[model samples]
Target: MEETILVLDKIKKSFDGVSVLNGIDLEAKRGEFITLLGSSGCGKTTTLRIIAGLESPDSGRVLLSGADVTDTEPNHRNVNTVFQNYALFPHMNVETNIAYSLKLKKKKAPEIKKTVAEALALVQLEGYGKRMPSELSGGQRQRVAIARAVVNEPEVLLLDEPLGALDLKLRRQMQLELKRLQQTLGITFIYITHDQEEALNMSDRIAVMRGGVFEQLGSPAEIYELPRTAYVASFVGSANILTGRCAGGGDTVAVDFPGGTGSALRRDWQGREGDSVTLAVRSENVQLLSSDDSRGIPAAVTETRFAGGMLRISSKLEDGTEVVISRYGIGTDLVSGDAIRIDWAAENAVIVLPDSEVAHE
Candidate 1:
């Protein structure tokens, strides 16, 4: 087995008696791009700060390249962060900013220049070395920040929403650039972002955080398909959840929902006959037909929204249960007041726990 480049063992943190992180255990392999994905105030930034030595964890250990660095100062640890605000020295030029850390290390002038040059080239900012921070674009400033961190050649790179400041197009471009950089450099990257698309696009593995704990961790496809928790399913993407009771089948379970509609079992949840369960289906997995009684019970159309090449048809069950269906090839006939049916395969559904997150009460 490959040794983990970074590990957080039994980490905890709290502020003003409100817990932000509750015993988080995570590991990062060498050169792996791991994104800490969650909404605002989910303790993602706090976790990054603790790992960087900027904040103290109540009780935990921070390891780097198999060395215990929990007590090491931010500068002493082999890690650096690129914050969202681009914390660049206002008075320094690009070259000076990149070489600032090397100067602090007391490296020779020639060595510092060479390292700075190499870092700038790595970030595709070779010719902009003499430009001031104020004169560069938001993306350029971010690249400079990245260059400064890479100039040190740290074992880990901590990015706290570094590309959040850029507009949509540039952010997408930078996402690609960052992925390429990680592949070329082979340094462990701990990126934090609230954008689901970015996390799904860039991460080798994602730690979905909510209520101060990791909800799920896996590859993008695995996390999307096999979300072990309800919060993870709803947070990562759009899901149409329906509540029902479990009924026994020969080898598989059957869920009989309200309005006499039954859906094939989505999971092997431990439940007795008549026990309540929530059945989840992704919008994309749902099948929509033009007429009522196509598959199961009739659904009353409530709203319709166009999403580029696809149409989102919203409907309510006979018991007023809301369900969303995503289908392709939009048509003018997709409007409210149309009665339809919702069809989905058994493999497309999942049974999830009602509890939000383990960290929550």
Candidate 2:
């Protein structure tokens, strides 16, 4: 069995009577990479701060390896945080900055030197120790901050959107690097980010927050394929949610949508006859075909966008419901006003409900 390294139990917090985290519960195993994903002001950062002991919850407990650390001071807790702003000492060189934490602990010169050298190499900045923060690029500075945080060998690392400052290309590269470092160091990472792609790419599990609580918690694949609510289906990825009514119940259930009717493989649905429901499908899961194919819902391509490897096609049905479809490669060139049809497999259809119904379930 995997060891549970961290646990947050019914954590509740409020600022001036305004609740930030309302009864948040989460657990993480050793060396697991967990991401707290949500939009701005959704309490993801507040949750991270609470875990790091930088902010205390108004109620509930924070446990590290079965011991309550809710009342522990920030420095006393077995956790460290890497902020988004790469908090580094402007006056100190890389070596000095990395060694500052160890030296403050009153370690001997030799021990500090050895540990700092290892930390530098861990982040692949072995020879850049003498460079000042201002002299380094944005990515390099971020690495230095990571080295400083990890040098002390904290059991859990809390990252608050640490890659937010870097450019798109550098941010993607650093995401991989951070995942590698977490694996290599065997430290549990509690990362906070609003970027859905980052969470999907790096985390073993994701806790999607909304309105001060976790809307859904699961593996990236599970969350994307089986979203519990319309919010989750729309937030985590590009999903086209269609209002529908349940037709019948079986291994494959029938759903009637405004544009068309379809069948979905039952996963987490409990709808009865005549009950209004919602069906969600990812844009990538939707298949676009020529109108003459004589299958699927008829739609007219309203927009064609070239997005790198995939072409995004926006189409509208006779009911005027717009749906987006992603086509890979350049097999068929499409333009606005082109006639097309879209369809998906039964298994690809996921039943997502309103937020309130999903929350109770």
Candidate 3:
């Protein structure tokens, strides 16, 4: 069984009379890569601060290694944070920066030098230790920041959008690097990010936050495939959300929505007759067929675009609801104003409750 390294129990916080965190709870396992994903002002950063002892919660407790540390000071906690700005001193070289913490603890020069060298090698910057922050590239500087944070070997590493400052290509590269680094070092990582792809790519599990609360928390596949709420479905990935009423079925629940009625596998909350619900279907799950196909819903093609390895089609249903479809490979012959029918298997459709109706755990 995995060991629990950190726990946030019903953490609540407010600032200036405005609530930011609403009784959130999370338990992180040792060496786990968990991401707090949400848009701006969603309390993800505030939660990180609370974990690092940089911010105090109005209620609840923070437990690390099964010990309560709710009132611990930031410096006293066995945790380190790496910010987006790569907060490195321009005057200090990489070796000096990594050795700073060790030196402050009054470690011998030989041990500091050996530890610093090991850290540099771990981040793939073995010989670059002599280089100053200004002399290195953006990616290198960020790696140096990571090296400095890891030199002390904190139990938990809190990364606050460490790749936000890098360009698109570089950011993509760093995402894999960070994940590999976490696995290699076996450190518990609590990452914060607003980017869905980044969270999906790097996280072992994700906590999707919204309006100061966690909308959903699950593995990447679970968050994308079986979101518990409509907000989670739309936020964590691309989903075509449609309002519907439950028609009630045995193995599958029939949802009556615009254009047509669709069947979804029943699980958890079985819907009552005529109860309102939401249907979330991924773009790739939507299949476009000939207009003559009677089994599909009629829709008018609005636009089609080639997205490198995939083809994206935008269509509008008779009720004016827009539906997007994505397929891999070359472009399709369908164009604007063309008539098409869209359909999907019952298994591909996910039934979710409205955000207001979703019960928090």
lDDT of each: 0.85, 0.88, 0.89
Collision count of model 3 = 0
TM-score for candidate 2, residues paired by index: 0.91
Clashes of each: 0, 0, 0
User: Over all chains combined, what TM-score does candidate 3 have?
Assistant: 0.93
Model 2 residue runs over 4 Å out of place are 289-295, 298-300, 317-320, 329-341, 356-361
Candidate 1 local lDDT, 152-258, one digit each (tens):
88899999999999999999999999999989988899999999999999999999998788888899987788776777778887677777787765335577765
Candidate 2 accuracy as lDDT = 0.88
Off by over 4 Å in 1: 264-268, 289-294, 332-334, 356-359
Highest lDDT against the true fold, candidate = 3
lDDT of candidate 3 over 1-361, digit per residue (tens): 1999999999999999899999889999999999999999999999999999999999999999998999999888889888768789888999998898898789999999999999998889989989999999989999999999999888899999999889999999899899999999999999999999999999999999988889889999999999988888888767887667888887788877666677778777666879986778889999888988876678899998888578899999887878899998775798899998888888988888777686542
Q: Model 2: which residue pairs collide?
A: none
The numbered model that scores best in TM-score is: 1
Report the poorest 10 consecutive residues by lDDT, candidate 2.
Answer: 352-361
